[model samples]
Target chain A: MFWNKEIETLSRKKLEELQIDRLKKTVKKVYDKVPFYKNKFMETGIKPQDIQSLKDVTKLPFTTNDDLRANFPDGLVAVPKGQIIRLHTSSGTTGKPKALFFSKKDVDVAADQMARCLIMSGMTSEDILQNMMTYGLFTGALVMHYGAEKVGCLVIPAGPGNSERQISLMQDFGTTTLHITPSYALYLADIMESMGIDPIKDLKLKRAFVGSEPYTEETRKKIEALYDIDVYNSYGLSEMNGPGVGFECGEKHGMHLWEDNYLVEIIDPQTLLPVKEEGQVGELVLTSLNREAMPLLRYRTRDITSIIPGKCPCGRTHRRINRITGRSDDMFIIRGVNVFPQQIERILMSTQRVGKNYQIVLDALDDITVRVEISKDMFDGNMEHLVDLQKEITGKLKAEILVTPKVELLEPGSLPSFEGKAKRVIDKRKL
Target chain B: MDAIKQISIFARNNPGQIERITHILAEQKINILAITIASSGEFGVIKFLVDQCEKAYECLKSEGMTVSLNDVLAIKLTDKPGGLYKVAKILRERKVNIDNAYMFVQESRKQGYLMIEVKDINKSMELLKGEKLQYLKKKDCYPRTKKPVKSSQSGK
Candidate 1:
């Protein structure tokens, strides 16, 4: 029943051996082709020969987002420019976004891993998959789209939003699986509730793969309760060739990060040293073992999570990583869009008629409500003027953040003034 | 033929919201002459015709509520059967559509008032003017109270 039973259930010894072999090849390839990794290797005085077993991987330098930023466009690409088939950029708060390149082989391997993940989650070729993720420069959608297609599923590339149409498609096509963000899944549930469409009785939804944002188990349960389906937690980033990297099996314990493709290490953020003990929370560091386009060496994810201690009952030797707890940075995600508080501040400060104080409040439904105080002179005691001002602010914020947020105008000095650090965000989400 | 000014507030559709609005008005000693709520899924619009409309609007605004003011036709009814039917017949004959309508009846005075929110308040007003309809001004929305007679009190 497994997509690749031999690789999935390989013994620990054989898996480690495969990992070491792939690691040595990846280190040599990067050192030979990409000057960024080669220079780092030279600076550390560690050659490709320095890496022997999996434990010696620490000698190589760790790659951070800053390093990616320094080498902006294609400095880290390991293959020739003609070999790159796809490119995805990870958003940053300032400066140019970090670009990731993938070759045809890399794409195929990603889809293969995705197929393994889906098969582990009990998906079969007979299933109908309705992918709800946005398909664009973002890698989340296209990768899963390829994976489900590889499984011979009747794939409906129904992109995100438009709840009524989504429901009709589900009703007409009998969609069996979904790939959606947790927030959008909850939002669709609300829409279904208002339209009197019961999930269990009306739709044929069996399960979902929720990712692209860090969510708590409580939020997962709420989604499961609302949709009457199991939601598997997925972990991936653009540097790792998008989401087929790690996924929860049918056991629903933890996400089994595909160790065959990725060498994962948990390190303390302060010490920058690997956490020796399992089940201890730390920042996730991943190295691409099989990627050809742009293989990153010990790439720091900035995501905080831990490796599960015990063996999974699924008979797979790949270790599982716990659900992501928090981020090492202050950036927050809403509606699957990465947003920074500084970005909001930049918009509010530049916009005319905006007061000195503004607050970004995230509600339980994963909706963002930006509470902005109107300047003293701007509040002219006219409802039309106030409404127009609110609309203008919303348009500006949406243009910057790529997601429309509900804007609320308040009286001057309505928001509390902070002494030192102004807490710009008030997250009321139960998650 | 003055149209009544109504205050409308945009709020999340949840319990205790109407209570919150009414409590604010009650604390300000502003009486609600007429009220109606229209919900479109998660959020709804709460409309109100208050005794002191400007004061209530300003108060709600100061409380950081998303409130707006609009004009609604306040047609005086016949205070009996076929009262609304008469208006409806005239509206239908003239092709004047009502987006929303609610009634407020003062039993003591045998006076009935019908509030109709139309697409174009002035156009509807002009169309209904020649239909022998009397419109209630803003001040006329309040119920009239009679002074107690001294002779009746002494006899009692």
Candidate 2:
């Protein structure tokens, strides 16, 4: 069975031996059935007999996002559409969403992985899990629901939004665990505070698993302080069978990758070559060890991270990856320097004068200017003081971001509010 | 001495407001020497220094734009390449720097007039004369026959 306890917590040598054994079997399975893998292996001149160990697996051609896009809908499915029990797709905000299929066994393995993640978060079988992720084509809600059920937890299938209803359910049902995005958790905290119920005191939430987007450490700290719950970062992609691919333990240093199910690789995004040293940030490439319906090999995730190869403080035998810094595609270049929106957010949260409601407007000028509108709460007293505050903010932004930003002290609530993901950066500089 | 006048008008932050203001002056053939706009999200204050101030004011207010007239400078420069640069250099030498300045080309006359806000008006005027630069005062730019409308409507 894939969920063997010996395999789950095997020694380093034993784990490698098992991984090679399973990998060899999985390789042969894909090579025989999957046309895509057969063609890929043939093109690379790598025969199934030559792949004796895991190291030889790298000889195969790497799969990319373009490959998924080209083979959209049902191009990559190994089994017929009728045999596939469930279908889910990754959020293709930039382009078309990549479709993922799961057989009954595939679904069970995914659920077990998620259950292992929840168990690491200190969730008990008696705990109630409130899943705030969206249901439907999205796998977050369903995968988490099944995983929590596997752990014998009372599952609340209440999806995203309707904070009042969620609070009511939490109060009524004594919900002890929450599965939500960081932004939604912040929104919940804000709502609870306005309703005169202290979130830390009122909610019986023991742990929160926040994922789905790249959030800064400052944001996690703020959420933790507000709700007084241990916020664990869960990392996964729909293309890789949703939210239980890997999870952070109590140490919170990095998320331990479920190496048994997926072989995680860190490669330089541009070169597509393996990153030699540890702590060097690179794009994540994933290969499913047991995915039968549609197994992806060397699939570039575009998420930039470094691996912590040593044994985790949590005593898990699986390797850990540092919290994702940002994605290569999401990077914005200004004045020849690459900038990520999360970097600006981190700097903004660190500053005392600037609030969360900020818009970085890049105009078509020789000197790139950033107009940051400070929230009204950051401002007190008169105009002169506000100007001083603006100068202070501008100086700090320059020091950290290495660019001078034009700071504007706007009246409280001058910026547009977001109901979902906050649109932080506005790049007006068109190529 | 030719007169120069500064006018401040209240305008909504919608499309065609600028076009309406420009249309009124273009109808009367009044030349706009320089213009500046200070705007928030919803509204803007349009400040203009025009050659024919009184005629421009009557035309603008007649178009229902709330306008007010004030005194400013209209310094003339040669149509040559470095004319504006020489004027700025002279002012910098005299320590009579400009706080704000705007300009436009006169297509028919082949000359450029600069409407500038200086640190000190008297010092700027003295430096202009000292440097042999020609300029127009507020009164000289406007004709006395045209009168502004006296209404209870405050532009603010």
Candidate 3:
């Protein structure tokens, strides 16, 4: 079940040795080529030669999102323009989009790592993968497509949406796997139900790689039951070469983050220091050890998760990290209480009589309103039943988030359907 | 045949929502024989007694509206003051709680139908049978007047 058995199961001592070597090279290259890293190193008074051990990576200046934005286009590129083979940008819904460049070798290495992830997830050459992620400037679709092709699977480049065609392609080609966002997977299940196509009986899908949005384990279980397939949680961002960074093996416990390619760290957001103990909630910080075109050192990912403190039964020496709980930036305050959308998602998905889609609205008066769709089967044509369901959702949310949010029960398709990532929060409160 | 199939739609309690639902039914050529809307907070349930219940359900569902169909007793209401009270008393005497009810008059036939939603349809039907109340069949729920009663006259 391993794409590269030797590298995937590399011993901890050897993995660290390989990591230190790659880290040293990446630091030297970034300092020599990219002025941002050179200026950062000069200001910190840390030389590339100073990074002699893996622990020395802590001395490197952290790369924040603002730093990437301030640098803008090509300021972070380490290699020559001719050597760059591809480029991808972040989904910058707020301001300027951060860009990442890839050289020819960088593309190969990303594909290799993704292949390892897919193989570890039990995909083989015989499987047909229908990649439902958008194949554009975003790195999610293309990188996964390359990885699935590397695994020798017949990849159907079926980009997002056009649900009928996606299902027809699955039926015609006998696709056994899918690379989709968790929200889109749920949305697809809705589409299939309408089309009267039962995924368990009609299609040949055995597993799905769901990522690009922070979702709860409850949502994963819901998708799993809907399709009767194993949903492997994928963890990656465009800055870290899309979705090959971390992947769950067949064990389905936690994602086995590849240590040889990237060094992972968990640090408290407020203190900006490494957490005292493993499994404590902290912001994830990653450094690209093997990337050549854009070697990010101590890049603050701003994703909130913890490094699980045990060995996975999958036997990959590389440690696993829990699913990304929520982005540090996605957390919002209501009535002096911090709430992540995933917390609300967990409550809504686990509770009965609640549907798959929900929206959290923060109005001008600082009141929180949670809009949820009623489960199709739960409606018994009684108005009191709908009222009771709304109150139940409100009670459950209040018990979890400690805010008595006004729950609005909407019809199934009243909320906007997401073709890409589902935008669950709307903060209209005047600051 | 004892119970009439009623389609209920969950919609936002806003202006034009009924217009939208009626438009969708009109587009599908489905006739709304009798209709009632009950609002609860921000949303309301629009229940309909349509000429083609299954077609209406499929069309509304395909239009991506949250809709459901259930069996409810449809009894002919006598055109008198005690007509509603008579059925209410029967239900109260039988201890069958009425969840929802609506009445509409048939302009063409001078007949009226009272739709009643109770917990148990069969039990309520049995209770009304001893009272000699006439239950409307699914076919009887349709509007007797076709072509708006003006278009055909204009053609003549």
Candidate 4:
């Protein structure tokens, strides 16, 4: 039943051999077809033949986030424009959007990879999957749509927002699986509770695929408890065909990276050296093996995660990766303490009456001022309730980050609602 | 005391925001009968008693501004030096809290009206009724409604 039986179950020795072969082909193809890769290769003095083994991959130059953005639209496509059939743009929350091109062959291979991910994550032909990720230039919706269709799922292309309609569609269609982000899933759970609908009793959702942002273990547990469904972590990026790179197995442990499709590496962001010890946290770097329209080699994904060493009881030989902790670029130091926004988010979410949005502003003052939106229900009480909440959040933050922070309780919906990635932190010190 | 419809507009406390909304209302020939602005840091609230409450709220909302309409307290103030102080003194004695208030006189300058929001609407109205306070009905300011007032002489 494996989509690519031989590739998925390849032994470690054989998998590395396959990775080396694909890495050589990708390096050579990009060097000949794309000028950017060629110039980088010339500057680094590394030829395609120089990569004799997978270990030699360290010699290759890393294609980074800035490089992709600098090239912007249509700069990195190795194939002709006519050959490229689809394009997905990065969220570009802060700067210019980076374009990702996919040829028809690339699309098919991505679909195949996604289909394999779905089957492995307990999707069946009889299951009706509602793809709730926002559609259009966003890659989450369409990639999952094609993959679920490949698995013969009756797909409900319900885009994001309109939580009532999402729940209605679930009840009407008897949807069994969903493709959505972790935040949206929790948001939907909240909506369900407000609507007096018990999801476990009213819906048929058996499992979900949650990713595109780093979430905490608490959120995972809360979402699972809320919906009574198993949540599987799915990881991918726009540069690497989106949302099908690695997937969690039935073991509910680490996600197994599709080694035949991508060569994965965990490296220290500062030293840029691979972490030899498995399960050590580092930035995840990936090289697409099968992508044709745009072959990105040694592309720095910036996602922080660890390599989960050891065998999966699911019998899949593909190497596993731990859940993404945070982005390497997303970390900020406050009062000499390296604080991640996700860490703040985890603390905020675990507390009661906290809304879906919070803003951490680091300005001229060295300390951070966090404005947390108190859910609507809490605002009806006296001002003391808010002062207590502020104290509670401040105390928890101090306990979590080891620094006392200035916390303000804002009314719900005071801050901007993000349709894609939530922009929770604003480092105004730069501004 | 009559509660006149007052619309509160929530706008970012940035330059050109008040000018922006006033311009939009001016384009529609909507007269701002009374206005008061309150601000806290980067955002503020502007409450107005306009000629057309529904029209102004709809147009502003259609233009994508966060605006709301509430029937707040509106009463006529004697066009004299201690008129507002007298009303405030009586209300303070009764512990009738007024959340916010604004007053304006028409071009005639002989009569003025005050728009206010109180902690308890019924309590404030009851305590201020025996003062022979002149409460401005919505029609006095709007002139577009069909409701008839019990006494035209009540604007005493």
Candidate 5:
């Protein structure tokens, strides 16, 4: 019953063969068309023909986020401007956002992988799927929308937010499946209970695909119990053509990453060397084999996760990836918006009243709160003025991160200071 | 006009903050004639009308406490319940804004004294003079007997 039974259940040897073939073509194309990659390869004394087998991939240099940022608008483009059809970006960065371009075929191939993942998440052509992922420059909504259409399901591109209207649409359309983030699922469940309508009774939702942010097992259990349905974790980044990169099947173990289209490697961030052993946490470095417009090689993901050792019960030959524990860097996502504590520090440091020490507390995915200490001299016993300062910091933080955070002003020495690594972010959401 | 010196100290409403300030003043042998506390949330203002206003202001300021002194109107009234009501009604009638004020029981016991900080002290003083109300000077507020405590104050 798999969407693409042959490819989904391909043998490991066959999958590796397919990956190597595509990887060679992608390398040749990038070296010829993109000077950024060409210079990197020339400096490293390697040619496209040097990568004869999958094992030789270790010789290639890694593509880090800094390289992407340095090559701003179209510096990393492999394909001509005439063929590029779409562009998507990550939420927020200090400078320009992470950009990914897709050609016509790249778009179809991404949707095709998404269709396979949809089938794995228990969606059939008979199912009426309601997608609640956000749309626009963030690729979550549009990718899933195209995939659901490709699966021949009755699709409602609901986008995100407006929980009340989402409930109504689910009832009106007899929706059987959903594509939403795990945090939003919890929010919707609470809304359904408040409306006095049981999700299992009033809505026809049988299963859900949750991703775009990391969530805990306890949250997964709560979502499954609240909706009386299966909750599958999906994983992808905009650099990899969004949500189609990997998915959880009926087995509900680690997500089965599709290796036929891309090359995936786990490397120790400090050493930058491959961790071949399974079940060891490391940063995910990926190379796009099938992407035409922007064929990224050894693109460092900065996501810390392990590769599950054994083969899955589901026939997919692709290796499984454990749920992301944290980022290799300080970047964390709140309600789908990527945030860095450095960005917060920069904003607070620029403001006059804010002190040197600040802490970010993410209690839940949606409950993002920042506690900052104000300078003692600024607290001149004026209540109205203090409230004004609080409001000012709140507005500035919201504008910087695109998500409004509850800002609190503490006294001179309330927040803790660390001598070592500075544990400024306390993320209780990932527990 | 001899200005009625009022010292304002800004502090957190923590447990030992006000106690510490008052203890320092007590050790300094400074007479605290009138005091008022207005606080909202974690922080507030502590106003004081003491015998040595400049000394107390410099003392707290040197100790890194946020403190400031403002010249205010010190009105002398009869020691009765209606004394404050008469002063408030007069200021209200004359369109003089009283920012804040506090009254103290004078040593004579027959009369009451109030230190009021208003928007314009000159205008309020003119209005008080027209109403035949007596405004005390700096010398009348603090006594000559209190001048000998500074040597011991600075000795510690």
Candidate 6:
């Protein structure tokens, strides 16, 4: 089967033309087979023929997380259960997990997209890729495994945790590429340093593909410095067919969306209209170009990002997207003020003598007050300096987030440490 | 001094919640003499030293709060800045990790009593005893005075 090669490398005008054609076809397909889409179309009184181009995409109703949750298990699946070969799901922290189905053809297309991601990150068939993501219900490990195999690379299905074994495999098997979250990689680097094993010198690792959670630039630098490995950020969701939907090339400018397999749009989050300006951040809305069992149309990702046009240094025709800054859901309002945990993290990391170990505590004291507990580094002497550090952090926080956060410098190693995503924000104001 | 139980209650950090807890104890006539709130964000564990430890635990538990009866070393140290550091250094040398801790000072004695909850209770007690740290039982320091006898005797 041939992919949309022209659309992948097409000019903006021609790419839009191709997208309009595919979107029309996708809408028609969903209208014919998928009851959910057909009903939505009928209710909106918009015919599939009317959606002849990308501009007319807004004519169709927007798909949401609630829609997926409402449909539940097989309610949203376009193909029959017998036709579906694989299933993936979100964590379902909010409620019941949103399940997605994939036909054999759909799985192949996803694998191809993943292969493209690996290639973008400079992976070769000669390279042995060590997948350190969580397996089973989580799609990171398995999808990367399939995609690496598709790229003709030697795949080692080493799921997350078990750092000793991961290091051993890296040393013994001569693993050259690593697929894991950025935080876990840092944890591995910390362990390697404590063991006096220089990951840069001891292991033959060259490229590190990091994702599964949003990361900061400082954290990225720390990881790169620890292993001396070139880090490329990968972006995808279980809803969008796992960690191969888009990836960063060698230029490291932005993640190149596999436009052939997905049509992407950046829309004003509040207005739900197309963002007209360049460099303006908006919500990412994706339409699956070649999904079979469950193709999504205008599905709001809720991830804030900007689109970058022009040719990439890697010569791939696919469009690039700026790194996702933060999630719309992660933004919490306190005292009629908006706050993102990432902004607090950024401020804390920028401060002197403060490690990345910090947590935001929102307490209800008549009005909401934000308390930030920062883990102190033992090496940074002068306890009095911490008072000044706290002042500086409070000042910066008040300036950036527009609130004077109560900053507490805890004793070294006093705060809880996590092997997984660090719990940075604790909202106690709800009580 | 009899061996008195100390209970740690984890509650969401909020205003008036602590007052509600104190009110429950007051209603049950369980006099809480010493308490320290070590809070981070909206949640923190409130460590209490009450006259009737069992009654206090029952009161808090009946209120549907997750309360744990823990063995903590209530040691009296000189009310100075380095007093905490000395205790921390001793624990470090003994290889005992302090999971959580809190402190309160008696105005009359001019000394700070720290309630340290360590991972290894036996090791911590042994170390404190071996080092001759002035450790006191919870009831020995309950109420800081013997004024609650009339209420206990009246049984009202």
lDDT of 6 by residue, A1-431 (tens): 11234445567677666677778888888899888989999898989999766778888888899999998888778877899998888876699998988899987878888887777677788999999888888778888888889989988889889899999999999999998888799888889988889988899998888888788777777888888888888789888888878888788899888886788888766667887776555689998877888888899998877788678866677888988877767666666666666567667767766666777777775233334443322222222344566678878888877777777655334468776667766777676
| Stretches > 4 Å off in candidate 3 | A330-431, B1-156
**Sort by TM-score, best first: what order?**
3, 6, 2, 4, 1, 5
1 or 4: which has the higher TM-score? 4
Lowest-lDDT window of 10 residues in candidate 6 chain A?
Answer: A375-384
Classify candidate 2 by CAPRI docking class: incorrect
The weakest ten consecutive residues by lDDT in model 3 chain A span A267-276
- In order, the B-chain TM-scores come to 0.85, 0.67, 0.83, 0.83, 0.84, 0.74
RMSD of each: 18.3, 12.1, 8.8, 12.8, 18.9, 14.7
How much does candidate 5 score in TM-score? 0.58
Q: TM-score (chain B) for model 1?
A: 0.85
Return the clash pairs for model 3, or none. Answer: none
Interface RMSD of each: 6.5, 10.6, 1.1, 6.2, 3.8, 11.7
What do the candidate models score in CA lDDT, each in turn? Answer: 0.83, 0.75, 0.86, 0.81, 0.82, 0.75
Q: Tens digits of per-residue lDDT for model 4 on A1-431? A: 46667777888889888888888898889999989989999998889889888888899899988899888887788988899899898876678888999999998888989999998987889999998888899788899999988999999999888898999999999998988888899888888998999999999989988876777677788888888899888888888998888888888798888988898888867678997577766789999988899989889988887788789888889989987867888877787766667668778988897787999999777789888776644333223344567789999999877878888766456789987667878898887
Between 1 and 3, whose lDDT is larger?
A: 3
Candidate 5 — which residues are off by over 4 angstroms?
A330-431, B1-156
Deviation of model 5 at B51, angstroms = 57
lDDT of 1 by residue, B1-156 (tens): 888888887665689889999999899777887788876544456889887776777777777676777788888898878988998899899889987788887657588888888888888877877788877864466432133212221112
Inter-residue clash pairs, candidate 1: none
DockQ of 5: 0.10
Per-model TM against the reference? 0.58, 0.60, 0.61, 0.59, 0.58, 0.60
Report the candidate with higher TM-score, 3 versus 5. Answer: 3
Give the winner by TM-score. 3
| TM value for model 4 | 0.59
How many steric overlaps are in each model, in order?
0, 3, 0, 0, 0, 1
Error of 3 at A308 (Å): 0.6
Residue-wise C-alpha lDDT for candidate 3, range A1-431, written one tens digit per residue: 88888998888999999999999899999999999989988998999999999878789999998888998888999988899999899967678999988998889988999999999988889999999999999999999999888999999999999988998999999999988988899998999999999999998989999887777788899999999999999888889888889999988888889999899998866667887788766689999998888889999998888788887887899999988877777777888776778778878878888798999999988899999988776776778888888888888889877899999988887788796567999999854
